[model samples]
Every structure is written in C-alpha cells, then in structure tokens.
Target: MEKSIIIGLDIGTTSVKAVAFSRGGRVIGEQEIAYPLSTPFPGWAEQDPLEIEAATITVIRNLIQLPTIDEKNILAIGLSTAMHSLICMAENGEPLSPSITWADGRASLQANRLRVEHNHIYDLTGTPIHPMSPLVKLIWMKENNYLPYQQASYFVSIKEFILYRWFGCQSVDYAVASATGLLDLHHLKWNKEALELAGVSEAQLFKPVSPTEVLVDLDKTIADQIGLPVHIPFVIGSSDGPLANIGLGAINPGEVAITIGTSGAIRQIVTEPKSDSLQQTFCYGITESLSLIGGPTNNGGIVLQWLKETLDIKETYEELISVAEKAEPGAEGLLFLPYLNGERAPIWNANVRASLFGLSLRHKKEHIVRAGLEGVIYSVFHVGQALERLAGKPTTLLASGGFGRSPLWLQITADVFNQEVQVPISHQSSAWGAAWMALFAIGEVTDLASIKQAIPMQENYMPNPDHHKIYMDLFKLYQELSHTTHSIYMK
Candidate 1:
C-alpha cells in the first residue's frame, strides 16, 4: 500500500513553494517557483497577481507531477501565505490593480495620520498603524482615488484572491485577517471603527475562518490545471508567523521562534489576545483561544546582502560570513544601525535610513561586515527585549530561516540573547507547519501537540557569557545612538 502524503503550499513574497510530506512528518518532495517584484514608483512595491497565480499553479502542478509521489495517495494541501498584501478586485473576480505587498510604503502619509489620530487602532486590531497594513493601504486609496480603488467592488488580500481563483469563494484565515489592521482581536470580527477609518465596509472583506477549516471539491478548472483530484481537502492554514512557531515546536510559553530571512520576526504563542502598551509589538489571533505576539524587523539578512553587493564581495555568502567571523565582538567600536528598509516594531518608522555610527579609519571591510551582521542581530535583540516583557523571557530559542543555516550567525544570535538556540533539521518550517495543520484538519493527526514531537531537531547553540556581556554594553550604545539620531532620519 502506498503511504498517504500531505502538501503544504507557501505563498511567500518572493516565491511560491510546494512541499510534499509523509504522514509521519518527513519531506517527500518539494518545488519552488520564483517571481519578480514590480516597482513602478519609489517606495511602491507591487506584484502582478496574475503572475503570482501562474507561479502558484506551476508549483502545485510540479509537486503533483513528481514521479516519486503517487497522486492517489495525496490527502490534502494546506496554505501558508505572507501577510499584509492587498489587492482590489473587480465584480467579475479579476484584480483591478497589482497586489500591494507588505513592503510597499505608498501609504506613508495616511499611515502617519492614522498613527496620530487613531492610536487606539493598535490595541483594537493588534496590528501596527503602518503603511504596510491593508487598513492604511485602503486609506491611501480612498484619499488618492486610485483608479482601481474607485471601480473595485471588493478589497481582498493576495491569499483571498488566490483562494477565490481556485475555490471560487473568498475567505481569510483568522491570522491573516488579524494582520490587516481591521480585525478586532478580542471580538474576532471586523472592527466597525477601523472600517469607517479606512473608508471600507465589512461587505468588501472575505469571511474570516479558522486555520484548520477545510475547503473541499476544488473548482474543476483549477483541478484540471493543477492535475489534482477535485475532492482533495485544502486546509486554510494560518499566516507564516504563527505557523512557523508550530513548525519549530515553539507553541509553549517561554519558547520563542525567531525567523530571519530577507526580513525577521520574533514571535511567541500566548493564551489570550494582548498588545503592548507602548505599541512596540503586534498581537495577532492564531486561533479563537490563542494569540501570537511578536515584533517584526524590516532589516535582517537583506542588510548583509546589501553590504556584500555594495562592497563588491565576489565570494559566496558562506565565505563572506567566514570573513566576518574573523572580527571580534563589538567590531572594534564600529556600530551599524540596520534600517536599510526603514523599520518595524519597537520603532515603526519608515522614514529612517541605515546609519553607521562610531566609524573611523580603524574600521576595515571585515569589521564593517561583522558590524552589519551584529546590527541585524541587535535589532532582533531589541525586539526580543520588548517581547520578554510580555512573554516572560523566552527560555528556548527556536531558530529558522536563512540566518539559521549559518553557524556563525546562530552563535552570535545565541550569545547576544544569552539563550540556547535550537535549529530545526527541516528548513521548510512554515511549509511543514501547514502540512501538520492539514493532517489535523483531516483527522490523521490526533492533536497539534503531536507535531512538536514529530519534528526533528538540529544543532543547539549555547550563549557565551563573555560575549553576552560585550553585547549588553554595545546594545546600550546602540539604543542611545538610535534615540539621539531618531529625529535626524525623519528629515
């Protein structure tokens, strides 16, 4: 008899990935389809929804066509999508505008005004009042009278758009809706006040559902396009951040999940919905009874990528990291504030740019590279500090994403946080989490906790007290520099 398999489809910012896993949580096959981002104007990041849908179809089709996998034994496909993308849809179900990605800052002015006028929004919705949010994006559209916004019959996220295409019905999972700055975290419904503020109505939004909700009987056309059975169950998984916690087995209190790819976030699962009093962190509902709170940083490995390109470093990323490893902690008094893409969490300012402080003739290329790495880690550490206030100081660090693949970066992160970091053996944490959710939805898995026991753990990194001491001092300096120069960047 053939083994049953589950597929996880991750619709990310840069690509669409499909991972097939056995019922026992082992990966069987995987495929990824990369797509390009469009920037027609400065600070405006967009992607063609049609292109993304095509890539999604390609990935799913590729996964189903793998010779090693038996299509008959495939049980379900679960979804995990990047949050905060908005798209305007016409009455006929076609997108009227490009999908505005989370990185887009075209609504900065509106977001600034909302931040001042509607400061209570963060508490109500558990999403920061930032231009990246769909609430702010809608406000911008209403103010600017964008052509698509004027003629659209509805507003939806990229995930909803894709689901509508495949399922012929629009729906958003709880976690995705919570990131929109429009959902009431406590009530688990669209906040009327937020709707009025954004000049939108609840009718324009998709119905919110739980992550484990299953959608069966795929649209015949979509099924034929993907070469899959129409009756395969499609589980609507939660957003990447919350699902990543499940992927890394960080569902318990005092266990934090840190994912650093192009961007980074530090998140933990909590029992109830709660937001930071200072609005330094975002709290989104993962399920009716559980919430995921964390801070996201716009700067992460991207800063390192920018440094390598700017310095014309021809070596591989591994080689660059090796060179950076040569530099001692603190990078000889040179500090870098990694706000290359502005920032989120703690300081949710989009106007700020990257800054290098305490630079002198003493600093060399290796020192600069090392400082850059330290800067990103420091930014995450800053957010972690804020998180510690709420989550009670994470006892375990479950690390994932591109940065987790590097031993040097892992050690630096562990040392900076003064906590032991555990990396998962499977790098596709989000996808696996989605797959596990599908298993639960289909009753193949007994409960969510079983996922934790099934996932394989990799190497563990322990903190060095000596390095932690140095980082503590440098972090203080970093904070001082950020506060003192905060006003300068706004100009």
Candidate 2:
C-alpha cells in the first residue's frame, strides 16, 4: 500500500528543517540541518544562497528517498522560510551574491536615511525602518556595493531560492513578501519607492501570491534528484513566523504572538488594515481575513546560545532552566541588554552592542545566565506593550519557537507580559499552519474558528502576581537602561 505524505520545509536563519506528515497533521519523518552564517566583516551576516538551496535539496532528497516511504503517494510540498534575508541572482536564475540575513547591520545607515526622508518607512512597509529589513539591505548594496543590484537580475527572499530549485520560478507567498519591508503592508504589493531605492524593477521581485496557491510545477531537474516524479505540486509558502502563528492556532484577531528562535517577534493578529500610532510596530496581512501586526526584536534564543558558549555552560537547556529556576525572580536586579546583533522593533539602533547592567561581585554565574535569558524574554514584553496599546487591550498570548520547551521561559514570559500564555503540545506551528492553510485552500475549513477547535492545546501559563510585581520593577529598570544605553550608543 502506498502512504501519502505532505512536506513542510522550514528554512531558518541558523538551520534548515523539513518535516513530512500525513494529511491529518501526523508527523512521520523529519530532518534538521544547521548551517553556518559567514561574517566576513563586522556588522555583516551572510550565507551562500546556493548553500541553503543545496541543503534544502539534500534534505528533501534524502527524506523522500528513505525506504518504506511510498514515493507515488506524496501529496504536496510547502515551504516556510526566514523573512528579510535576500538573494540577488543573475538573469539565468543563478545566485550572483551571498544573501544578506535579517540580522545583518551593515545597512543601518540606509534604513536611517529612509526613515528621515520618507517620514514613514512604517507607513510604506508596516515595519519600522531597521537594518533587519531586506529593503534596507538592498539599498545598502546600491549605495555601498552598487554593482550587484545593477548587474544582477532578481532580488528575492529565501523561499524564492527554494522555489527556483523546485519549480524554476521566483514567486513569493504573501507572508514572505510582508517581511521584506518592501511590500505595501496594507495593499500587499511591492512599494514603488522601495524598488527605486533597491535599483531593481518589479521584474526582479517575486510575483506575490497567496499561501494556499500551488505555484510550483515540479521541474524534471529537481524532481529526478529528489526521487519525486516531474509535474508534482509545490506551494510558494509564507514566512516561518506568521505560519508558526497559524500552526499554533494564533491566527485569529486578539491573539498575541510570541516566538523565540534565533530571533524573536511579538505581534498581534488583527482583521483591519491597522497601524500602530506609536510608529513603533509594523503590520502585514496574513490573509484577506487576518492581518499580522506586531514588533520584532533581534535577539531571542541567540542570547541563550551565546551564554551557553561564553560561560562554558555546557549543561543542557533543561539543566540550565533548573539552574535558572533556583535564581531569584528578576535575576536579583541584574539586567542584560540583548543587542549583540544590534536591535530592531521599538529601539531601532543598530550600532549598539550587548551589555549587562548591575553586574557586581555579588552576581554569580547562574545570576548572569539567568539575567540573559530573562532579559531576552523581557524585551519581548516591551514589544508586547506596544502591540496591546495599539489594539486598545491585550490578547491571548501564544508562545512557540524552540525556546518554548522550557517551562521557566514560559512562566517568565507570562509574568513579564502580565498575561496568560499558551503553548501547543505539538511543535512547529508554522508547519501546522501551512497544513491548515492547505486545508483552508481546499475548502475543508472556512475560518479560524474551526481551526481553533481542531488544533489541540497542550497547556497554559498564568502570571504570578508576586513574580509579576518583581518583573514589573525589573522591566522598568530594563526600559530605562535600554533607552539610555541606546541613545548613548547611537550618538
């Protein structure tokens, strides 16, 4: 008997993952491969787009090639990629340059100039003007490294690279387009000013499409290598973060998004073409019915990963969390500013560096470690405040990402935000979201209300008043130090 399976490929900043599942969303096989981010210069982080392409291809090929997997029954392939990171390829679809990752800060100056001149990078792209945006990265290339955009053909996000490998087209899912900071957040199309600044034409960008649209025609070249026959179907999927929200059942309005990965973002779902008056938050459409509005911070699990290496803290995450549990709430007044890769969202400074405040002789290694973790989680709360303010109130916070596995992290997140947070029993809500999107496209589900009922909830963490008060004090101190430090650093 042939077994049919659907595949979701999540191409992330620090790693690439492909998970195979049955239509009911039962996982059968999975593969995760980490890749290095080359930093040839300071304030710069890049990766060979071809390398990412090859890795995705390799994983998918090996995945479907495994024995006991019936090749003929494979249903569809959907992709979810890290947003903003872009590849500039030649006319023939060959990569002409390394892709600038969403974390790269070399383009901070370009973003700043745009903010000053345009008066509303926020209005144009829903996202604040920041170095993390692909538009800024592209502009940086033209002003600082001009030849690439002038000579190269297309400037695209990671999924376009994957689509080219699979079906030989440069199409983008709306989720991915929104992240580029080039798409008109309200209208869901590329901004003319963004294109002019990038020195590229509309032809160089992905033909924006919906998440549910099947846009790939299995090219024989890729099909033969992956053990799948030619003419198979592929969907130009959406951004990993937004899809994670869908997979987590956080798609509906009033749902706050909290994701901790290589980077983190806290956003809320809205139904209207909403904009944050603070000019601090960005907006993007999830679908005609749902809009993704939130602020994203540049640091998350990366800070934890840094602590693990810096303190020679070779202990596993669980062990580390146990240690963190023993530490006093608020890390005993210690504060860590997570700007190691610069910052985004509310604080738009890119030249700023990471630091620890209130570090003293009394602080132990555990205290230092605990402060780093809490600081990163607390930073999300800052964004959360802006989101809630925009919506006139807070919403049900849904937490996902690799970091959500830690109970301590979840508790701190809830306490810091002073709201209850939910976690899914099954992980990778992005993939789950993609599958649910597939179901929606096929007419299985009409709206998110049904998805809410269908998706299972694992657990919820409520805020502890005592702990919340402690974090409130710490967060106030955090905001003070963050603003003072950012102003000084930028100056």
Error of 1 at 384 (Å): 0.7
lDDT (tens digit, per residue) of candidate 2 on 20-111: 76655667777777888999998889998888878887888877776745667676677788888888888677887788888788887887
Cand. 1 TM to true fold: 0.98
Candidate 1, residues 331-409, lDDT tens digits: the string is 9988999999888877888877888989898888989999999999999989998999987888889998889889989
Give lDDT: candidate 2, residue 148: 69
C-alpha lDDT score of every prediction, in listed order: 0.89, 0.78
**How do all models score by TM-score?**
0.98, 0.94
Off by over 4 Å in 1: none
Clashes of each: 0, 4
Model 1 lDDT, full chain set: 0.89
Top model number, TM-score: 1
**Model 1: how far residue 75 lies from native, Å:** 1.5
